[model samples]
Target: MRNLQGWEIFVLLAVVVLLFGAKRLPDTARGLGRSLRIFKAETKGLREDDAKDATKDTTVTTAAAEPVVVEPRPIESGVAQAPAAGAHAVHRDAADR
Candidate 1:
């Protein structure tokens, strides 16, 4: 719980300048700023996407809670019913081949 004094700030800046020369400091700061901005934007987008997905899930759950009624199809006697579209059917009769 200690606040940095002016001397500490000056010393930290001096060390940073020594580590990465004065010429490269501006470029480094700019790159750091850009990286932080990009990270913030990506995190914001992810939060928004999560919020949208949560809403969609809630809506889907509410809709699913309602009962659905399905009508039964009539079948004809003595007739082989064709399978529905996109369904695989196996023929049991060898004579029909």
Candidate 2:
């Protein structure tokens, strides 16, 4: 659409003034400006945070990290193996009552 002519702009302003009244116009504009300012600041902060994360993801660690290896113990037949450290042993007799 083409830009509004002078009279069209005047008419739009008149309509807004009539709808909201003269007294409320400044307050409404101020509130709208504050909202836009806050929105802009938050978006900027998010962009900065994303940039930081991108940098963090690109950096290489100097020291080589070694993978941990765990060996499993062989299970013996016909013997009740005691529970490993920090293991909770459940008694079936208590649950049956």
Candidate 3:
């Protein structure tokens, strides 16, 4: 779009004044300014967060990671027993009732 001339800008402002009235113009402008300021701050915070994430993504760790070893605990019983599915369903139904 072409840049508006001074007269066009003046006419636009005059139209706005006519539409919203002179009394409400300052309040409207103040609200618009506050919204823009808040929007700017949020965008700046997002950019900083993205920059931090980008840096974190590019970093190389020199330390060699150790492999995890998990030891299993022995059961008290010599044989392992699995519960029946029907028994579980029956227990749940009884509890619900």
Candidate 4:
């Protein structure tokens, strides 16, 4: 296979424009750009989530090594009680990264 040059790309685009009409070309281009942007955002979000998950797995192993069973505190009136500070705090620490 051969690499396409600038002129070749220009000619290809011109042919596409002629086939699709000048008015529809802008709309098609805009749609293509939006699709690309969405794809990039989704891919980046997945990568970050995977990294965060890997960190959590490592932290889980760390927590497993430390023998602890923290309990929940009593809630005041309408507020919900948070988990006790020992092992629960470690999970939060891993996720924050």
- Give lDDT tens digits, candidate 4, residues 1-97: 9999999999999999899999999899999999999999999999999998877745333333443456556678988766554635334344454
Candidate 2 regions with alpha-carbon error over 4 angstroms: 58-97
lDDT of 2 by residue, 61-81 (tens): 675444444444566897777
lDDT of 1 by residue, 1-97 (tens): 7999999999999999999999999999999999999999999999999998877745333222333344444567977776555454343444543
Arrange candidates by TM-score, descending.
Answer: 2, 1, 3, 4
Q: In terms of TM-score, which candidate is stronger, 3 or 4? A: 3
What TM-score, over all chains together, does every model reach?
Answer: 0.58, 0.59, 0.55, 0.52
Overlapping backbone residue pairs in candidate 2 total 0
Clashes of 1: 0
The alpha-carbon deviation from the true structure for residue 47 of candidate 2, after best TM-score superposition, in angstroms, is 0.4
Query: How much is 96 displaced in model 4, in angstroms?
Result: 36
